[model samples]
Target: MNDEEQYSVWPHGTPVPAGWRSTGFSGDETTCLAHIDEVWTDLRPRGLREWLATRS
Candidate 1:
């Protein structure tokens, strides 16, 4: 996920693009999605700061 909490899934062993870091967990599709749901509590596409600004 980015600073904005937006994420994309690339094929295993593919090179990650710039400005992204691995969450360090890898598995089949079901496992990966469960991990995301556990960790990614905020589903907003905007960064926390940006989202808060909009709410205000």
Candidate 2:
């Protein structure tokens, strides 16, 4: 994930993008996606979530 808290699947053994880091979970595409679905319940980005928190 990046500063935005978004999740994506990167090919194993490939270098991750500059702003993104591994969640330390590596697996096949389906498994990765399922893991993301389970953990990333909040779809909002970090900035948006912080802003909403301030409003609340």
Candidate 3:
């Protein structure tokens, strides 16, 4: 997730698509979800950042 909080997921062994990079983690469904659960604690979108910045 960039400064934007947008993210993408591809199946195991799939090539990384253009404009995307690996987060250096991989696993099966349960493992992947566990990783996401641990890492993606913030669900807010990039728009929220922009909005908050304007408010400041």
Candidate 4:
């Protein structure tokens, strides 16, 4: 993402946190929500939701 892009926690040049990451260069203009969700899940494998899912 360029400096003009908006992010909640990812500030300008903030390296992606742990597994919650992106190269910040999804230039294809496609909404990467699912991709992002995957990364978020990876970052919180022990998270409640992910833990419950793994049990299913």
Worst 10 residues of 3 by lDDT: 1-10
Candidate 4 per-residue lDDT, tens place, 1-56, comes to 22222222454455665545445535222345544554554343355556689899
TM values, all candidates: 0.67, 0.95, 0.64, 0.25
Reference-based TM-score, model 4:
0.25
lDDT string for model 2 (1-56, tens) is 89899999999999999999999999999999999999999999999999999998
Report each candidate's C-alpha RMSD, comma-separated, in the order given. Answer: 2.5, 0.6, 2.4, 8.8
Q: RMSD (Cα, Å) of candidate 3?
A: 2.4
lDDT of 1 by residue, 1-56 (tens): 66577666667998888877777788988888888888877677676668689898
lDDT of 4 at 56: 94
Which digits, one per residue and each the tens of the lDDT, describe model 3 over residues 1-56? 44466566679788877657788777787887788788887678778968988998
Best by lDDT: 2
**Model 2: how far residue 55 lies from native, Å:** 0.8
Question: lDDT of each model, Cα atoms only?
Answer: 0.76, 0.95, 0.75, 0.45
Over 4 Å off, model 4:
1-8, 23-56
| Shift of residue 25 alpha carbon in model 3, Å | 0.4
For residue 27, give model 1's deviation from the true position in Å.
0.4
TM-score of candidate 3 versus the correct structure, residues matched by position: 0.64
Q: Tell me the lDDT of candidate 4.
A: 0.45
Residue 23, candidate 4: Cα error in Å is 6.4
